[model samples]
Target chain A: MIPNIFRLTLPILFGYVPLGTAFGVLFATQLDYAWWLAPLMGVVIYAGAGQILAVSLLAAHAGLLEVFVAMLVLNARHVFYGLSLLRQFRGAGLKKLYLIFGLTDETYSLLTTRPRGGSPQEEHRTDVAITFANQIYWVLGCAIGALLGRSVEFDSTGIEFALVALFIVLAIEQFKALGSQKPLWMGAAAAGLALALLPPAQQLIGAIVMVTAALLLQYNLQRNTTLTREANHD
Target chain B: MTEPMYLAAFIAVTALATFLTRVTPFVFLSRHSEHPLLQHLGQFLPAAVMTLLVIIFLHRSAHWSAPTFGLDAIGPALVVVVLHLWKRHALLSIAAGTVCYMLVQQF
Candidate 1:
């Protein structure tokens, strides 16, 4: 059972291992501990980009409230991930709580877009295993990298481009899955507008709220127009 | 002296906040709401957020002074975009892009 989980998490293993190593190295060099907090954050925080940002924040002696708010902004997308998976998680029992807690971006994408199969019981089991395996891979990476902290001689710069590519691929796939270009383009427009107008720190939430408001307006307008036309027709 | 304490507090608070982001929707929305608005946000928000995220990376990855758009990062970024569009493989595209960027940086 565990082996199956490892096999399924193979792709994430590639991404997580290296990325977690980067996080670990950064944490060790930049933060309070050279070895400890890597795995601790991996287990407790488990946020990828947010954790990276946290290292920078903590290194800068950011206040606790600042750290909290910055992380909240960095992780805002997670709320949407949880919302999407709400139905799938219904009555998932104690495991359901785990699922909610484990809803990282990569995990959410894989589970939500995964091809469904087997009985519900089998599926849930697979999910639990996958989550466990992915996080374990991450923790392992952090531990290994933290132990090897700051001793390596190599250029690891721009390695984070992989994450950029991952998000692009994910966005494209999500766009394809939705099969509606309207929301996506509008989203792009909203983001561009926000980026132009707001501070970098403020842009994400601004874009999200703008997109949400635009979508709501679009939906309401379409509904009202359809209703009006139907009344006239009748 | 208090640095360690502050660090611990920072980690705990951030962890709690992160946990809430993941759990609150499930806890609260699952109880009182099945509204289409929530449903729509779930469906469409990811693509939008991800698009913005990519934009953020693109903006951060380079500091272009000339509008000519230097080949510094764009060449590899374009590689990623094209590879993803053509091959539709996430890991493959990411690997290719990272390799391309690393190679470019060597120059």
Candidate 2:
């Protein structure tokens, strides 16, 4: 079980290690009382971007309402992820709950790319292992970064782009696999429109709302048209 | 009150939101779902969500508010896109892209 978990999550470490390290370094250097906040955020929040924003807001002494709203908005996309995974979550008992809690963007993508292909029991083990391994890498990365921040002084600038790079690569993989650019274009268009119309802070939520609405509307329209055509044929 | 106390409250609020976001779909689907709609969203939404992320990154890296043709963003993103296309290895592709971005930052 351990070996299988390691092998499955090994690829994720490449991205998580560096990305988590970037967050750690920033948390350690930029924020006050850097050490505890670094790994503590790693354990609790566990969402990468939300953690980064936490550091920024806490350092600035942002209001609690402000912090809560920002974190909620930043991580809102996790809801969309749950929609796709609901079927898989059924009949897994309590572990389905853990699976939901652990559904980070990378974890979701990795699982989708290669499902836990085994018996129901084996699948449960594989998922638990995968989630554990990924979080372990993340927590370790934050710990290392906090320690290094206390001890060393060096340039680790531009490392956060590791995340941007990761997302780009993942998006391209999904694009290639789907072999249809409709969703891609629709989503990109929604994001672009949101960026133009909404404020910077609200752009993410706006983009998500826009994309989901557009996609569902198009889906319903297509289905209705197909139904009418079938009725005509009949 | 101390910073840790404040931080704990902050973490709790954030964690609640995060957990709510994660569990809502399960709750929603269990309550009610149109088979075609839910299934279509499950199949197609990942691609769309990923694309949304890709554009978000593009906006961040490029710094859209500046109103200039920014190579800072484009050059490295292109490197990632091209490298992924060529190698088909996730680690190699990501490494090449990060190194490219880091190097570009030097200039």
Query: Among these predicted structures, which one has the highest TM-score?
Result: 2
User: After best superposition, candidate 2 residue A56: deviation in angstroms?
Assistant: 3.9
Per-candidate DockQ values are: 0.57, 0.61
Worst 10 residues of 1 chain A by lDDT: A2-11
Tell me the lDDT of model 1 at A79: 68
Predicted complex 2: DockQ = 0.61
Identify the runs in model 1 with alpha carbons over 4 angstroms from their true place: A1-11, A32-34, A56-70, B1-8, B66-70
On residues A50-110, what C-alpha lDDT tens digit does candidate 1 reach at each position? 7888888887888778888878877786766776677667767889877877888778766
> Over the stretch A113-144, how does candidate 2's per-residue lDDT look in tens digits?
55455787677667767877888888887877
**Residue B10, candidate 1: alpha-carbon lDDT:** 85
Q: Write the per-residue lDDT of candidate 2 for residues B1-107, one digit (tens) a residue.
A: 57779878877887777878778788878544448788788777877877787787667766434554667777787888898888877667677877777777665
Worst 10 residues of 2 chain A by lDDT: A150-159
Chain A structural similarity (TM-score) per candidate? 0.81, 0.83
- Identify the runs in model 2 with alpha carbons over 4 angstroms from their true place: A1-14, A29-34, A60-66, A150-154, B1-5, B31-34, B63-68
